[model samples]
Target: MSLVDLIARADERGLAASGLACLDRCVPLLGGDDEVLRPLWSSLADGGADGDAWGERLAKARAELDCADPSADTVPGFGPDPAPGSGSGAETETEAETEAAVSDEDRAAALARRMLATAPGDPGASALRAWADACSAAALQIHRLLDVAADGDGPLVAAERRRQVAVLELLAGRGAGGLRPALEVSTEGRRVLRAVVSRRARGRS
Candidate 1:
């Protein structure tokens, strides 16, 4: 099926993983290694997996992927190794090549790509994005809420604020639909949005 068809179908029937899978097929077909793969992987790695679910999938991808060197995995088009004396300080990171570790951004990107490869249009695609986005937003929100509460906003005000947010979220969600269906397909990036919707729905502080 065409990409537009896949996207429209995903939006209708909620098949993010499947949609992503379709995109993966298109990537190579369209020769979008750097443009498509990089962003896709960025989103996936940043998102996450379902414990063993993620690991098993990665294993399969590893088997299929062909890297020039097995020791270190490199982003397809990123700049090469640092200059000989690139180390400013007398020390450097791990004795092993820096390539061993995958940065959060890189991992997210890789995961996104993998999702594209495995389950393109599945709602989990949004879920992955939500999860990644939530970490930071939740952290900040928690800190702010705590500080605000400590200042003695009292449960009444806090409660009302939550209610307001909830109403707003519900209205917004209603404009679309319920939060449950939205969260169901979560992966990493979209999990945070789900929580906010949840908080608004449930009137949580």
Candidate 2:
């Protein structure tokens, strides 16, 4: 089945797993450890995205990601409020321009956080559909932001889309046994992302 069809037919657990797997694979872009999202995956076991386990593990994941370098210029879900008595003229303008130059890592981190935060509490058909849609968009955007191509579509994005579909289809066909295979697919994507990061760093140097 196509990715859309698989998503449309998938049960709540399948939908949640599909989205989470995508984000988990891209965690390297956020400078997150591979194991950081492990607890959230555990929550998906035993038919349980509905319980507090998912929420609790999500909170922990967010916390772990957040604790990295507060002064770093990463994007949060909401932009920080302008500080009281903060300068409003040339200084503000300069700061605004500086902030506009968000790093690729920061942008990827924002997308990952969006996937985590927007996951459906109920994991019902409607909620899961919405969440899955958001994840698809976010995943695509993350790949786009990381793409180094000077002109049009790059190999990175093409591979990411293929990996996304493969993951969903794996779940649809193999059910729970597919998780490992799905993760293996994600691992391949993660390697591609890592190569992209390396290439960008080398260019910068």
Candidate 3:
């Protein structure tokens, strides 16, 4: 089944896992350690029924990611746009413009951070559905931005799409049992993203 079809029919647990897996794979962009979101995943494995546990772990993950403020729309230092300012001269204006422009990397990271920030505390059916859909889009966009190939749909994007579809398929077929393999898929993607982030940093240096 298509990802959209799968998501539309996913149960509450499947939806939560789908969204959390997307964010987990993009953790490198948020500067999160490998285990920062482990609690949240464990909560899911515990059946994801305790909304309180999910909320607590979600808050902790956000804190670990330095996104403690839920109201903040953009990640600090990675804003989608430049801060407004007046330049006194043409040269100053040009410099300001350069500083104000957001890089693809920054925008990608911002989207990842937003995914974390917007995760629902309640994990209801409606909320999880919206967050899952949004995360899928954001994760795909992040991969597209970081993909170095001239083609918009490069290997990174293609792999991400496959992983996403694999995740939903796993959940659809195996129910809660699928969380483990789904996480394995996400872990592979996380490693890929970490490598991409490292390579980009090295290139910049």
Instruction: For each candidate in the order shown, give its overall lDDT on alpha carbons.
Output: 0.34, 0.73, 0.86
Scored by lDDT, model 1 comes in at: 0.34
Residue 31 error, candidate 1, Å: 9.5
lDDT tens per residue, model 3, 1-205: 8888888998888888888899999999988888888888888888683468899889888887888776668543343443456435785666557657878788888889899889998767998999999999889989998998877799999999999999988988998899999999999999999999999999999
Q: Write down the TM-score of every candidate.
A: 0.22, 0.76, 0.87
Alpha-carbon runs more than 4 Å astray in model 3: 75-100
| Residues 16-76 of candidate 2: C-alpha lDDT, one tens digit per residue | 8788878876777667877887777777764547888887777678678764332233454
For model 3, where is the 10-residue window of minimal lDDT? 74-83
Candidate 1 C-alpha lDDT tens digits along 1-205: 4322333333212232333322332232222332333333333334433334444444444344432122343342233555789765433454233545543234334333433333322335465343323222222233233222555554423432343233223323342342233233222223332343345446644
Ranking by TM-score: 3, 2, 1
| Alpha carbon lDDT at 59, candidate 1 | 45
Q: Is candidate 1 or candidate 2 better by TM-score?
A: 2
What is residue 9's positional error in candidate 3, in angstroms?
Answer: 1.3
Clashing pairs in 3: none
The pairs that clash in candidate 2 are none
